[model samples]
Target: MAHIVGGIFTSHVPAIGGAIARGLQEDPYWKPFFDGFHPIHRWLAAARPDVAVLFYNDHGLNFFLDTMPTFAVGAAAEYHNADEGWGLPVMKPFPGAEALSWHIIEHLVASEFDITTCQKMAVDHALTVPLALSWPGADNRPVRIVPIALNTVQHPLPSPSRCLALGRAVHDALASWPGAERIVIFGTGGLSHQLDGERAGFINKDYDRFCLDHLGPEPEALVAHSAVDIVELAGSQGIEILNWIAARGALGPDVREVSRNYHIPISNTAAATMLLETPATLSKAA
Candidate 1:
């Protein structure tokens, strides 16, 4: 059976992509955020995940307000990244784990998640940025991917609790898969920051810290707040934390935080990165 290595959560702010494109890692403004990934790089080098299951929100690149599924899973052979006009360069195509993708799609449907299936999908910064951050190189990344997109661009987003359940269903699917591949789950986007409205540029450091502290050990505590409450407290876009919540659910009940870094005002977003794996995995690695 396939083995789930662990989960990695991070903020997928577009500006980080531009910083990489321009080689601005050492720049004072971007240095702190870029530096945070060094430990993640070391961990990936050791863990070497074969496939990445990304839980991310599309930003009008693949889905629009007129029509967007609450959840969509990619089953493509290859996933392409297009320029989203955010001053971020287009990224090389990411290879897809087609068999794994289909398996997850089937399992999700069987589990009554009512998710949309995409034979072809164009990924945006939400998916690409995390990949680039984790595997920084000019060539295509070594690992294949299965992109799972949740609707956060429009109203009626999936509740935090529902996303958590979706993650649990995915965990079950992976558990039943027969492949020997090692998998890593990625939950990308937000600590907190709003881009528009009178409360534009809003960020709640206290809330962000609260989430970072509890997401690994007490993920259920986060779902206690309704989706609306998340928006009001974390900001509208901060609802992206739902991605993190879902990723946490897939880790089973034994999670250990390996590393975490938090920095403020990364494009007005409270950027964060966390690495979590089973305590057994950590002990074995030790």
Candidate 2:
């Protein structure tokens, strides 16, 4: 059966991608942020999972107010990056795992979670930026990806508990797959910063730190907060924390946090990255 090797949590700020594309890693303003991911890049090189289940929120690129699915999974054979009204360097297309994607969709629906399957979905920075950051060179990234889009942009987003349940369902689904493949799940976006309204540029280091500290063993503590509470504390767009909660749930209750990095003011967001794995996997590695 397919084995879930680990999970990654990250912030998907668009400027981070721009900084990388411009070769500004050494710039004093961006050095600290870029430095944080060096270890993550090395780790990915070693772990080398066969597939990545990326969970992110679309930022008005693919879906609009007209029609939006609360949860959508990409079933396409390949996914191209969309231009989010600005000229961001489009990366190479992301190779998809169609059979695995379909399998996950079927299982998620069967598990009472309604999921929309997309055969031709245009990915935004939320999906591509993190990939670019983690696996810098498009020419050499061998791992196929399965993009899972969550609706954190609109009102009535899924609650933290619901997102966590979805993650658990994903875990169960991957476990049931008959292929002996290594898979890594990713939850992308937010450590806390607002980009709109009068409260723009708000960064709550304390709350972000609180989330980073509790997400591993006591995820329930983070889940206990309502959406209103999350916005009040973490910021409005901070709802993206649901993605992290879901990734946490997929790894199950017991996980060893391999590494973590948090930095402030990464293009108006408190960027953070974390690596986690099942206790059994950690033990085997030891």
lDDT (CA) for every model shown?
Answer: 0.91, 0.85
The count of residue-pair clashes in candidate 1 stands at 0
lDDT, residue 50, candidate 2: 92
Inter-residue clash pairs, candidate 1: none
List model 1 lDDT by residue over 1-286, tens digit each.
6878888899999999989899999999999888889998998888888999999999998899899999999999999989899988877889999999999999999999999999999999998999999999757587999999998778888899999999999989888999988889999999898999999999999999999989988998899999999999999999999999988887777798889999998999999999998765676588
| Model 1, runs deviating above 4 Å | none
The alpha-carbon lDDT assigned to residue 73 of candidate 1 equals: 94
RMSD of each predicted structure: 1.0, 1.3
Q: Model 1 Cα displacement at 218 (Å)? A: 0.5
Best by TM-score: 1
Clashes of each: 0, 0
**Inter-residue clash pairs, candidate 2:** none
Per-residue C-alpha lDDT of model 2 across residues 1-286, encoded as one tens digit per residue:
7878788899988888788778898999888877878877776767768999998998887788677888999999999886685567877788899999999899999999998889988888988878888777655566889998888877777888988889899888888999978888899999898889989988899889999999998998888998778988888988899999988877776887888998878888999989887765666467
